[model samples]
Target: MGGRLPLFRDLLPRGLLGRSVLIILVPILLLQAVALQLFYGGHLDVISRRLAGGVAGDVAMLVELLQRETIEDRSWIFREASWRLDLALAFEAGARLNAVERRASMPLLPLEEDLNRALEERLRLPFDTDWQSDPRSVIIRVQTPDGVLHVEAPRKRLFTATLYLFVIWLVGSALLLSAVAVVFMKNQVRAIRRLAGAAEAFGLGRDIGTIKPEGAAEVRQAAQAFNRMQDRIRRFVGQRTDMLAGISHDLRTPLTRMRLALAMLPRSADTEEDLSALTADVEEMERMIAAYLAFARGEGTEQAAPADLVELVQEVAAKARRSGATVEVVAPSGLMLPLRADALRRCLGNLLDNARRHGRLIMVAVDTVSRGEPGDEAAPAWAQITVDDDGPGIPAAGREAAFRPFASGAPGGTGLGLAIARDIVRAHGGEIALEQSPLGGLRARLRLPV
Candidate 1:
């Protein structure tokens, strides 16, 4: 039983539902137990007191008969009153008295050594209490011509019965309530779980269809709101992607014409400077336009197959090194992560390029893990991709703004690199953040959920 308790405990999440139910039920059970004790004790006290009062009356009657007979014949009265009451005759008057004397008390006659223990074990309460301290209890008194007898029975026996009954009722009730709560809560959680799974798929760029709301009204409202938001974002993205594609296509013809005209111009010393400036301006404009188009197209949301992340990083690093950039794969071993092939590579390539362009030396590392089961020790299921550099990192205040389009702080560069990288990463169900690196510069940490 003890072993199974831990097993049951592990099946539940550390959530509010379990805690709330426990908080509510525990006190109620305790209260019920206490109430049962008090109620049973009260009932027993009433019964005992009535019986004691009846015994007192009978004793009084016996005393009166003895007194009258003694007044009439003193010797005869002494002989008759000296005889012990017969069990058979006592039962004829009251069957309960016979049972009490015979079944409850008969064994304690001459066995003085075991008398107290026997009575307590058989007829006394299961637990002990001070009956003398309690006002409500049975008080038996008898008066004879020779002497007076007094006895008191504690009300603890009643309390014990009540306690036992309370436990029985409580256990039965709690079981039924818990079962019902499980069924109802399961139904509520099922819909929410389904919605969460769908949301995860959506986050990972999977085509999740509209979810039908379920459970309580509030949950349904939240599901509906999410659906509406998703639809709006998708529609806006589709419209913008088409618009950017058209703009890029249209701008290319005029750009081609301008380049041809510039090339056809007569050559001169001043013309060379003027043409270089013209070309630079055109190229910068073109690059800005391309970046805008990429942003508008929602490039990250594209569906791509899984690729070897380590290999991808290695290839990017190789390319950068060939371009005379100081980028190295510090810890690229065992980086087998499930990821969007093109998008993930693009993200890493952009980050390395950014580091080389802004920072001095660049270092990249990857680690993969699996999430653990409840009560079972295991690693978290995710892959962390870290890009570290020893460059003049962006200030804390402007770090957030650096991801926005055209928000660059470097000379001879557009500020679109980080933004594009983030979009691509997020589309693959990953997050990218910039923080102080161990390399004394900026650290780009990317976490991808498996």
Candidate 2:
């Protein structure tokens, strides 16, 4: 059962269009299949039986007429049966269905059964009916004292025209209707796609324009809710940014005055160290303020554009190498995604800086992978970016705590790297996780939908 779940999970579609069409189409197909089975099994069988029985009766009568009439006179009777009864008559000497100078016949089972039963009840003499003996006719042999009488009837007698027409109409109508449904379904899903795309872009903190809701009523309602939510989030971020901006402005002047006052103090060894300490504290306070303002203002002011992830990671690696950090990278070419390039770059920069500061050997890689079945293209694939390093990794207990604002992983650390990275990642509709890397240190894995 556990194994079966994965098989069905892989087979099912991952998108609205495919899923919706599948949902509508599967039952229709099944119903048609059931209908076909019922028609073929029940009604078609009855029709074929009646037709075959009629052909068999005509065949038996032709055999009887050929048996009674003389050879010369039989030609005229044959012509009469051929024209009136539609049975082509022939008489052959010494032809037997037995093994010596004969062959067994393979008949279409439905026709064969009906013809055999009808001929048995109607005919007094021994006879052989071979449904498959001729492609265009039903062949019957009647054993007589003089010779064997061969009777040929048109094969169309064994099949009803209405049956063929019904089946063809059923199949053709099913296909035509399915195609029309697909066209309408694609249009309906198009509107839903627009709604989903807008929501995803907004969640990623991009400056998203409004979406015109055009789907079913429920879908339109969802889109309206999404728009309202976006408005509220933007308003809240704007208010917070304004407040933080005012506070930072008010505190800077007093800090500068205090710094100048300390610098102008008389040169005394007793107070110099204390003044230096105060200066460092003020600088740290300013750094915290900047980090706070950055976080508060990150409600998505950037427009989205297509950016190559591989090149972005490579550029980060090159810059870190220039600063004397050993970084190894493995990435595929042409890995493009719609993103806020500057914000993503800053987010990755923070993670790399943090890793480089703690670990000696660092590695970065960008790859695309399926969330479940690897080969299924329809299953959603994620673009994954991994940064690994050789340093003591964070404990499982502190991993979640590390993403909290102002919660530093180490002593004397600002503790905003992972938090900011997480914020930026989540805004892009991605996820970041901390885990133990193969290099014996923390591994930062980031994933974005492609």
Angstrom error of the Cα, residue 152, model 1: value is 22
User: With candidate 2 superimposed using the best TM-score fit, by how many Å does residue 394's alpha carbon deviate from the native?
Assistant: 3.1
Local lDDT at 209 for model 1: 73
lDDT of 2 by residue, 206-245 (tens): 6776777777888888888888888888888888889988
Which ranges in model 2 have alpha carbons more than 4 Å from their true place? Answer: 1-19, 26-38, 93-109, 124-126, 129-135, 264-266, 304-341, 352-393, 409-412, 436-450
Task: Summarize candidate 1's per-residue lDDT along 12-89 as a digit string, tens digits.
Answer: 557655654665577877777787666545754455444434433433444455446534454453344335321001
In terms of TM-score, the best-performing candidate is 2
Q: Cα RMSD (Å) between model 2 and the true structure?
A: 4.5
* Model 1's TM-score against the true structure: 0.65
